[model samples]
Target: MVVLAKAELEQIALPAAQPPMADVRAVDLSAAPGPDRAAAARTLVAACEEQGFFRVTGHGVPQELVRAVEAAAAGFFALPQAEKEGATGEPVGYGCKQIGDGGDLGWIEYLLLCLTSAGTVPAASFPFSTLPCAAVCTERELLEEYAAAVRRVACGLLELMAEGLGIEPADTISRLVADAESDNMLRVNHYPPAPRPEQQAGRLLTGFGEHTDPQIISVLRSNGTTGLEIAGRDGAWASVPPDADSFFINVGDALQVLTNGRFRSVKHRVVVSSERSRVSMIFLGGPPPGARLAPLPQLLGDGGGRSRYREFTWMEYKSCSHRGRLVDDRLRPFEN
Candidate 1:
């Protein structure tokens, strides 16, 4: 990854402007099963339809665990560039600035890890295994624990969505994410503060470019500093207020297709803060490579209504998404 100097950083800046706060819905995941749970499910469905985004409270993830993982991430990113680079691996390790081979750049550094079916990082290929911090078992433990907890929250949300949609089996959607060969992933992003010159100019740098997740869903948690924004119904950007205690859920492209357009896959991006750094942890829940993807029949009208998207395997869609730019309409090629 190429490190940008002050001049290069300034060149990438955009005019700073505050966006209106999004009127995002919040769902209480701890709601008990009967009428309460049903009501929560309805709200979740409405949120998905309205913004393809929502906040989750009573998610059951321990605050201490979240903090521990954040601290560990801070420690890892604080290492010298060379040391941090040592953990780099193909598509699943330390990355700086450049988002992908497609030439997209951001004012961000990140750690990407693939999770196993059991929700644990593979020991042999652990990205941090060679770092000095590897000896600190607590760091690794924190990652595993955090992944497991977040996965539960993600799957639970999927089930709630299925219930609200009146799908027969509540697990119909969650099952893919829980599959033995699921391609789940965890990403930790660190967006450092902008350069002083850029700050003085009141310019905002793109921490992450706008794009929709290719998986079924994404669960994200970030520190108090705000930078995240999602596209509103009018195609204008709306700022998402930071709530470290709550989890934000995003409907992914796969989910949008599965629901036959009833749900939307939102476009979101991040801008860098001049004085504060932003750190976010995201859990991307995907299905197995071989799993078939198509609009669920239940969502279609009687007599097997026409499908909006052509049938494709998860691997095929994943490949297509990877080959395109961040803002490309990935679903266009598969559209009927």
Candidate 2:
């Protein structure tokens, strides 16, 4: 709902203390690489090949802005129940109300905003990023400013991804230039302290549940919290910690599919602490509501560039996802 000029900010860059494995090293590498684009590109390729995620340094988003947003989200969620509930309920048909379920929760609040003025409301206005925030925090321009600034970083990333694929990075990213479905979202997720065990069930039954991103990719900035869990290659879950002044990158289903499994969309969840609160700013770049999603030309393995799957919009995929059943079940259909 707002936009800010890129000129009003200061950024600091830090080196990757060590080489990362298909991972974001909690540094800044957004619109421009910290040291060298070619070096950053190699790091990015290595990350997606193995880790499927990475932390970027030198993206120009201020750690202060990240702190401010997290603080605002915490303060907003800490408001009285009535105030918090005012922004809770959401339309069901669009699967928005699911965010409000699991009641008697901690003081975490959420706010989402749809950047593009595409196909009118009533049909598809319930974007996941624009969850409502407290009125006090609503008036601040930093949220929107941060979004626009990060968008540039996203564009740069997309193009870099293209280059990593051995194509003209600009050519692979052409669809994003004027495409309505090349969407981006910003969210402020707050986690308030939990009561004693007698009063709360703790993280397993509270806070945000386990979920994988539905976008092409997600970039996150979070305060030092240990609740995040990553499923390692052994099918075991490992707790992922936060590094100071860095962004976390994770691939989404769309990117995974488009890249013909070259990229992976991993499942992650937040575990709320019984004592300290947590807040994080998340940005997801996904295809538009109805943008057709399928494997990309270069990522396809065989048939001289044949795609492996049919194209489906995110809404379609989500509709099937809401059924809570795997779309491709083992029950074989009769061949005619």
Candidate 3:
């Protein structure tokens, strides 16, 4: 847990090429619009194998929609405390750190919404009838649009990953993880300004403790505020500065399970800034609630025909993740 000033951040020297904790590859989706997907696939695969994280640009998401979502988030968080509290619920709604599960509160507030309905899937099929954004209608509209846009990008990335793995993209991993009935959650995190900007040991504290996401993939967009950090291959932490031009794509525990440990699920944390509030939107993709997950047969090799992990349902995994402490690999319990 360290905070570096702008001068200090600039002073830290990194390797000329392939820096230890700072190398997150960026891929342009629009580079080859005609299905000749050589360049993007190579970069995407390499990034996933190296760190399970990358930046994506030319993703075709409208800038106006992004801005509208950001503005709506800001407005929603600015509402009265009671108003925010009205949106609080179990897995889907507003949550303040002080009232978090087991009292291990992070110094942040969030609104979680379930987005399970798609084409042909009735809107009533989801867990919640309406989003927590009833406080602001525009927020709901913008968030729904943003979620669809992000989902498209996620699916496209999954297709590239499938091609990289030399597998059937539409019938295997991508299909399973992004199925119409899959459990998809959107998290809107609001890290309020820290009360003490002068504190040395506990500067801003941590918005969220270090942990790997339990879903298949996470697509995140930040509002130009630095708070996220990812652990590198050497167990050292590197800051991920906010880049408006791209979304930070992170592989999650479910993906690692599907890849049989070839692709990693990076460990990351959010560190708050004492001087400014920060907002980030994250879209989570995972298997259907009742779907049983394990290392794909195609991914398993000739180790006496053994799999790295035992089969487990998405519901069971989600329960394990929420019940246990948020640290280290949450998938270890199911490892064979």
Return the TM-score for each candidate structure.
0.95, 0.73, 0.85
Candidate number of the best lDDT:
1
RMSD of every candidate to native, in Å, equals 2.0, 10.5, 6.2
Ranking by lDDT: 1, 3, 2
Q: Write the per-residue lDDT of candidate 2 for residues 87-157, one digit (tens) a residue.
A: 54243111111343332222344666444412112213233223455443353455566666566666666
| lDDT tens digits by residue: candidate 1, 77-148 | 888888889888876989998887667788899999999755788765467755556454777788889999
Ranking by TM-score: 1, 3, 2
Candidate achieving higher TM-score, 1 or 3: 1
Cα lDDT over the full model 1: 0.88
Q: What TM-score should be assigned to candidate 1? A: 0.95
Stretches of candidate 1 off by over 4 Å are 5-11, 133-136, 198-200, 302-304
**Quality of model 3 by C-alpha lDDT:** 0.75
* Number of clashing residue pairs, candidate 3: 0
State residue 159's C-alpha deviation in candidate 2, in Å.
Answer: 1.4
